[model samples]
Target: MSGSDTVFNVKPGGALHGAVRVAGDKSISHRSIMLGSLAEGVTEVNGFLEGDDCLATMNAFRAMGVSIDHHGEGWVRIEGAGLKGLQKPAGPLDLGNSGTSMRLLAGICAGQDFDVTLTGDASLSKRPMRRVTEPLEAMGARIETAAGGTPPLKIAGGHLLKGMDYVLPMASAQVKSCVLLAGMYAEGETCTTEPAPTRDHTERMLNGFGYSVQRQGARACLQGGGKLTAARIDVPADISSAAFFMVGASIAPNSDITLENVGINPTRDGVITILREMGANIEVLNPREVCGEPVADIRVRAARLQGIAIPEAQVPLAIDEFPAIFVAAACAEGTTVLTGAEELRVKESDRIQVMADGLQALGISAEPTPDGIRIQGGQPGAGTVQSHGDHRISMSFAMAALRARGEIIIEDCANVNTSFPGFVELAASCGLNISQN
Candidate 1:
């Protein structure tokens, strides 16, 4: 579907069944392209997500003189340019809707010998960039942003950066990874202490590439002047993408589903933890290791869900899955309250407000707060919900259709390709009557 022409029509009363494996982890996919581009040898990646977001990351690296061969069927070969080997791109790096690409690449561009400008789509351009620019500037990398600290970032590279100890005001893996990537070019050691843990894909991928990233509790440290050797990476299924089905199966009656080869890294397993705490029946089976990260198969069965006060400590862990979790909350038995997640306001869309509006339109009682939202569980009637160009919001509403009273129309769903390319097909295969038009 054309970007402007994409929409989703979902009918009520469907259940997911059987087993499925979601696309490659979006977080790991972006890092694979990035770390692979900077390594010394050829990096072979299996199960790469062919989504627009990760593709944006790949294309950006390609513009920077990285040779990437896309073999059909999720196989990619990236010819690594050793650290400090990236050439200046001829024009601005357009990162599309991927905040991950824009922020993470800012760090990689910080130590280069050339000046670069990074821009994104309308939605991404509106998101904050100062979170990254501030830390990069403190390390002596000259940086500029649009008014209100938005994107269209102008980064002046080749400056000597000095390492510093930084404490993150919020638990954000993107910001943490940004500084860590810049730390690679700084003099001496750089350390970051987060208020809470975030995803560790960057750190693990660094170790897989033969670079040492030391972690102790909430703090992680990395040294400058290191080399990365290209290594084989088998990207696992993304838990965030699987979260829709996880919630779908949990809320829909007589539904049972298994998600295979999902990355269950401790830092990224917050959704599973939160769901279990809310009385979801999810099982972790056949645990193993893949490319330095933990992997397992998850089986979820339908159960009566109860709303509980979500612990703030789990906010950062399950941040990306909250949209889908909110759908589960609407189908739950009580009130679900979440807090300490004001970061949602600055995502691709204002997730808290957008979700609350959508839920209210569906006839559910969802109250949006400055930091979080409170939802009262009840049957959702048919309604049209706008995605606001956020992929998670689009998919989350689609999951809600399973329990909706009538057909639900989801607008601006084109962005679903940003993370999960075959979302409609996958959902339909598992018994969801969802179609893209």
Candidate 2:
């Protein structure tokens, strides 16, 4: 669907029931493309994210001299170029709106002895590149970017990259993974300390693929110069994407939702913990392990939600899910306050300001902070919302509208196709009252 034609109009509830399975995990989907392309032999990935962002990584790898064949039925076969074997692309690689592709690939390109230009879609071009660029530059990679560390980054190779210690200013998986990917070719041990822990999929996947990586306390260290071997990876359903449904079932009157095959990696399970604390009856069942990541079935039943303060330390874990979380807060019994999360300002949009605006448009009282938003919970008076071209923003508030007083329409909803391609259909299947406008 074209971006302009994407608007979702959601009606009030048909209360949720039955178990629904989400698609592949977004984090694992990204790593599968990246690591598989650099391995020594053929790698097979099952349950990979077929969304635009992961697809951008696959296309970027193809342009960089990796042989990849997409056989029908969710299976991708990659004949890797081996570590240090990537060829320079013939022209500037376009990354669409995927920050994951640009950041992780920056490290891949830096390790090679070739020069390359990388550009992205308008949205990607605006996201801060410094998070990844700063760390790469510290490792002897030369990168020049637009003013204030935005994209259209020009990275020239040939510098001798020596791994060094880096302390992350914030919890960012992309930045952490970028440094680690470059460290794979560096001359010595590379280590990073975080202000708080972020998603550790890259670290775990590296270990699963036969690379020696160790994590201790707040630090994750990698022994540089190890070759990655091809391995099969099974991506669990994304907990981030499943958040909307969780919120939906939590707020919709008398609804009970079972979300199956969802990832419950501790670093990204803050939503569950926070929701459970808010008095939502959510249960995790059938816990299992896949490729070192925990997978579980989530069951959430509607209840009277009571909002509480979210700690600064937990901000990064639930950062991407906050917009929808605010929608959850709007229907809770008290006020929800969040802090220490300035990162939300630079996501697909200025999420703090945008979410505040959307909530106000819905007749829900919302206050904005320099870093976060505070939402006062009560019954919402319905109105149309603008997603600002953000997928999470589109689906999250749409769930909120399910229990709202009147009709709710989300404009510029095309971004949902980029991540959750069947969002509208899946919501409908879960007994949600939703449709595309």
Best by lDDT: 1
The lDDT per prediction is 0.93, 0.86
Q: Could you tell me every candidate's TM-score relative to the true structure?
A: 0.99, 0.98
Candidate 1, position 275, lDDT: 92
* Best TM-score among the predictions, by candidate number: 1
Which residues of candidate 1, in runs, are more than 4 Å off?
A: 1-3
lDDT (tens digit, per residue) of candidate 2 on 1-437 = 45668888888656777889877788888899888888889899888877887888888889998998886345788897788878889998998878888888888788888899889888888999988888888889999999988989999988888888889987888888898889987889999898898999999999988887899988999977899999998889999998998999999988888999999999999888788878888999999999899999999999889988987777888888898788889999989988888999988889999899999998888999997778899887778888888889999878987778887888988878678878888889888888896
Q: Across residues 197-269, which tens digit of lDDT does each residue of candidate 1 receive?
A: 8999999899889999999999999999999999999999999999999999998999999999999999989
Clashing pairs in 1: none
Q: How big is the positional error of residue 169 in model 2, measured in Å on the Cα after superposition?
A: 1.3
Clashes of 1: 0
